[model samples]
Target: MTVSVRALRPGNRSDAEAFARIRMLALPYVFFTADSVEHLTARLHPDAHFTALLAEDDGEAIGTAQLSLAHESPEPGQALLNVHVRPDRTGRGAGTALVQAGEELLAGLGAHKVFSWVLDEPADRVFAERRGYRPGSTAQFLLLDLAKAELPPVPAPPPGVELRTAADFADDPRPLFELDAECTADEPGDVDHRLGDYGAWLEETWRHPLLRHDLTTVAVADGRPVAFTAVRTDGGVRYGTGMTGTARAHRGRGLAKLVKADSLHRARAAGFTEAHTGNDAGNEPMLAVNRWLGYRVCAREVQHVRELG
Candidate 1:
């Protein structure tokens, strides 16, 4: 059986569906949708050189890869080649083929380094190592059985603070954008992402299909957004926090916990039976917060990096 890999056909409904399906099957912990996949590939910045690659075994897509440069990073030549093969189709050559196409594209784009996320499982680790990639930081995929987990009671916002949803900022989201920019800048990760392009953020994140603005909670102080727990839903019973953080000025006021708890409670009330979120293993503060929310670790993934001359 010969496996052929090529760039995804943008605006093709079948391509988007196949890519999203393979992603959901291979990485069940995360949420994805065909619309989101199409939106990302269509709206990506030109400098990123983003390509959604598909590996086909006998004309059927069995592996998917998202190749692109980390354009927002201050570092030069930083690229990503994240490959995920359908679990049942792993033994075939599709994974390798997809990876080769990704690396070739990145190298052609003058990338000096490439990063990927591999499942912490032995086979995934081995596959990455065999490709000359070295393991770096680890992150956990956590799940909370909202129907059974004992959630802490939502607390009232402190004096001069109010609880609101991301929907409240539809008129003008620059405040939320500023808060996201600050918090994301301080995140602990192998790659540094600075959300400097507000217009890009609006197109790529704010208007994203999976973003549940109605359920995303924000804490405002003195009529300004301060902390937030951005939420995403799979249009099913599953819900996940896309990003949760507090502004630098509001760190110790328990706003992070407050917004997260409020969001989870609302998620459950709205019939979302399962809640999911991820955190870097080194983020002790967030780990503590999730523990308080009754989230248990379900899976772990490690970052793999390879340097190129």
Candidate 2:
């Protein structure tokens, strides 16, 4: 039996389903759906040179990789290739084949540096190290049982500040985009990204399959969005916080906590039973907020970086 790596056929239902299945099996802490997979494939920026690769054995997809350049970053030549192989199919060399193919593709596209996320496990770390990747930063995935965990009561916004849903800005989302850009620049990550493309953000984030605008809570100050908690739901029992951030001037005001609490309360009211979120290990403020919300650390993934000259 031989394993071969090839690009994913986004239009193929079987391929999309197989890719989603393998990803869920490899990393069950996050959310991945067929619609979301297709959405990503269809909406990637042309300049990013995005490609989704699949490793197949005997015509069965056993691994998947999402490869793309960070087109929106201020720095050039930054790329990401996140690969995941089915748990039961690891020893078949699917992971190695997938990473090799993904790296070669990104390198061909002129990527100077490449990054990937490896689960915080011995085998996973060893595989990355063997490939010349070095550990950079670590992130923790937190989980909360919305159905059983006791969530904090929603707090009232300070005077002149009001809580609003992302849905309220449907007519014009540019303010949210601006706020997103400000907050994203300060997010703790190995790669620094700049949300300079409002149009791209609209197509990629605002209209994403999983993003639930009604459940997303935002804090508005004098009609401007200062802080927000982005929500994503599977339309089932699982919900995730895509992002939670406050403007530079709004920090230390407890607005982040207020928005997050409002978002969680809305998520529970919408029938979501489980809540999932991730934060950089060093982001103590956000980590404290999650802990205060009753979230517990469930898993950790380390960022690995490899330089290609």
Candidate 3:
């Protein structure tokens, strides 16, 4: 069977669902839906040059790839390409074809440093290594079986504090935007992802299809949002935190834990059964919160970096 990669057709329900299925089969931890995939392909920042690619073998969609410039990075010419093939479709040419096609797109965009997050598995690491990528930092994916796990009780807010949901600020998400920017700047990562473009953030994050504002918890101090945990849903029994953080000025009050616990309790009460989140290996404070919430490490991914001459 011959494998070929091409841009995913926009507004095609079959293609979108196929792409979503492939992603779910390959990496169940991440959240994705046909609508979310289509939304991302359509709404990602134009400056990023983001594209969703599908690899087909003999006319059947077998793999998926997302290639784009890291437009938010302060550094020049950083690109990202993550490829995933169905577990039953590996050892064929699908993965290779996707990589070749993705690199061509990035190279044409003048990308100088290409980074990929490869699962911390032997075959996956070897495939990246053979393609010139070197291991970078590690991050862990965690899972909490909400039905079985004993979550920490949501803590009462201290003086001048109160709990709210992201939906409460739907009319104006500026406060959440500011809180996100501050936390992102402090997040430990290779790329300096500063959410400086409010318009881009609105199109990409605020209007994303899966963002569950109703389940997202916010910590407000004196009527101002100071900490929050934004959640994304599978539109079913699973939920994942998109972003969670606390403003530096209000760090010691356990606002991070407070908002997350509140969010989890709400999610559980609302019938969500599974919760997923990721943390950089070095981020201890957030890790402690996850542990306290009974989340266990389910998988890990190692970033692979390759500098283009």
Candidate 4:
């Protein structure tokens, strides 16, 4: 069977659905859908140079790749590529073909390094090592069975602070965006981030199809958002925490925990039976909050880096 890779068709519902299906089949823990796929392709910053590629065997898609330059990072020449093949279709060359195509795109963009997430599985690790990729920091994908797990009571905000949903800022979300930028800059990750572009944030995040604004809890202190936990729904029973963070000044106040708990409660009440989130291994504070909320690590994936010569 001839394996070929090509860019996902813009504005095509079929291609978007196929891409999302292959991705979800390969990695079900992350939140994604046809709408989410289209959103990524349409809303990404132009500087990001993002491209979604589909891998096919004789014209039938079997894998997907999302590759882009780390445009928002302080560092330069760094690119990201994540390739996932359908679990049932793995013995073929589709994965390798997709990876080669993705790397070619990144390298052509003048990227010096390519970082990819490799699942914590024997076959997955060997696949990367054979391709010259070296494993780096690991991340844990946690899952909470909201229907059966006991969720903690939402913490009461301290005096002068109150908890509200993202919907509360319906007319204006800049405060939430500001808080998100501040917390994102300090987030634990391999690539340092810069969220200085409000326009990009509004398109890529605020209008994202999966973001459940009404279920996303925000901590307001004196009329400003100091902490927040954003929620993403699968249009069904699953909900995922997109990000949870507190303003640097508000650290150690359990605001992260407070916001996350409230978001979870709202998600459960809204009929989402399963919840998912991921944390960098070194992020102890957020991990602790997840544990307190009864989320258990369901899978682990390591970031693998390969330098382009």
Candidate 5:
């Protein structure tokens, strides 16, 4: 069967849903929905040059590829192209077509490098290797069964620190933004990101559709956020921590664990049955924290990098 790739139409419900379905089938650990797809595509910074490509086979959507310039990276001409094909549709030409289309788009944008995250499976690694992508860092996806696992009790905050929900700063979330920026700069990753764009942060992270501010927990010190566990809910029974980190000065005091525990307890009490999070394979600290929280590693993915011609 012949496969062709085309740009996904924003605001088209069918397109969004089909993209979401493909993503869920290929990478169940990550969170995605039609609403999130639409929101992200519509709210991307103008400089991002982002596009969602769908691979169709005989009038049926069977794969997806998200291609974009790393507009927030300090390095110029860096691009990202993550392709995922439906499990049932593997071995078809869809994956190859999607990759070809994505590369063309990135090359047209003058990208000097392209990165992709592929599941750490034999076939997936082979597919990337055959196309000149070299394996980079690996990350683990974790799952915690809120209904069955035994979660550690929320710990008491240190004397000077106070626990609060992200909702507490509804009037002004600049403190949280500052903390997020600090943490993001220090996160273990292959790319160096420049998150100094406050306006873009407000649009991309603060106002995102899946961000559950009410369930997100923050640790405050001296009236400023020192640590936080950002939450994303599917409006169902699943909740995921989008990012959990502590300010560098406040590290080693276990504030991240405290806020994450609080968030998990609150989420379960509010009827969330499953919780998910991801950690870089090199990040032993966060991995330990997740283990202490009863999260078990469910899957692993490897990043592949290629220098564009």
Candidate 6:
């Protein structure tokens, strides 16, 4: 059978479904859905030049690649290409073909450096290294058995503070958007991102299919959201924490922990049986919070970076 890589057709439901399926199978820790895939293809910023590619052997989609520039980052020429091949079809040439196609597209788009996440496994590491990518930082995917694990009791907010849900911002989410921007700026990663564009955030995040606004818990103080734990549920039994953070002034008050615990409880109450989240190895405070919530390291993925000359 021959493998070929081509751009994804947004109008085709099967193509979108296949792409989401491979992503879920290869990276189950993260949340994905066909609708989310379609939203991404249709709504990404024009400057991002986002391109989703699929690798097909004969007529079956065996691998998928997501390529795009880090448009929100101040530093230009930074791009990302994440390729995942179906587990059962790994021995074939799908991955190689997809990666090559993805890299070529990004390079042509003037991306000077490319970053990718590879599962922290022998074969995966070797594959990236063989392609001239060097290992960088690592992240851990933690899982909690919501049905069987005992979660810490939801802690009451400090004086003048109250626990709220993302749903509370239904009438106007701009404040939550501001809080998200502040917290995202401090998130650990190689690229420094600025979420200054409200329209982009609305299209990319607020409207995301997996975003469980009702399950997301926020800490409100003085009529403003000071801390929050964003929730993403796979329309199934699985739930994931998209992010948990406290605003700059609210740090050191344990608000992050408080919000995350509240969100987890809501997720369990909403019928989610399992939960997953990821953290950079160096983020100790959040790691501690996850441990307190009974999340254990289920897998690890290493960030790999390649500088194109």
TM-score of 4: 0.98
Model 3 gets an lDDT of 0.92
Q: Which stretches of candidate 3 lie over 4 Å from their true place?
A: none
Model 4, span 1-309: residue lDDT tens = 898999998999999999999989999999789999999999999999999999999999999999999999999999999999999899899889989999998989999999999999999999999999999999999999999989989888888889999999989999999999998898887888889999899999999999989999999898899999998889889999978989988888989999999888888888889999999999998999999999999999999999998
- Residue 300 Cα positional deviation in candidate 6, in Å, after optimal superposition: 0.5
Poorest lDDT segment (10 consecutive residues) of candidate 6: 7-16
lDDT (Cα, tens digit) per residue for candidate 5, span 51-164: 998999988999999989998888999999999999999988999999989999999999989999999999999999999999999999999999887888999899899999
**Cα lDDT, all candidates:** 0.93, 0.91, 0.92, 0.93, 0.92, 0.91
Where does candidate 3 clash, by residue pair? none
Q: Name the regions of candidate 1 deviating beyond 4 angstroms.
A: none
- Tell me the tens digit of each residue's lDDT in model 1 across 36-82: 89988988788899899999999989999998999899998999989
Instruction: Give the C-alpha miss distance for residue 79 in model 2, angstroms.
Output: 0.6
Distance from true location, Cα of 127 in model 6, Å = 0.3
Say what the RMSD of model 5 is: 0.8
Summarize candidate 3's per-residue lDDT along 1-309 as a digit string, tens digits.
888888988789999999999999999999889999988889998999999999999999999999899988889899999999999999988988898898988999999899999999999999999999999999999999998888878888888999989899999999899999999999997777888988888888989999988988999987889999989999899999967899999998999899999999989999999999999999999999999998999999999999876
TM-score of each: 0.98, 0.98, 0.98, 0.98, 0.99, 0.98
Off by over 4 Å in 4: none
Scanning candidate 1 in windows of ten residues, the lowest lDDT window is: 2-11
Q: What TM-score, to 2 decimals, does candidate 6 have?
A: 0.98
Clashing pairs in 2: none
Cα lDDT for residue 250, candidate 4: 85
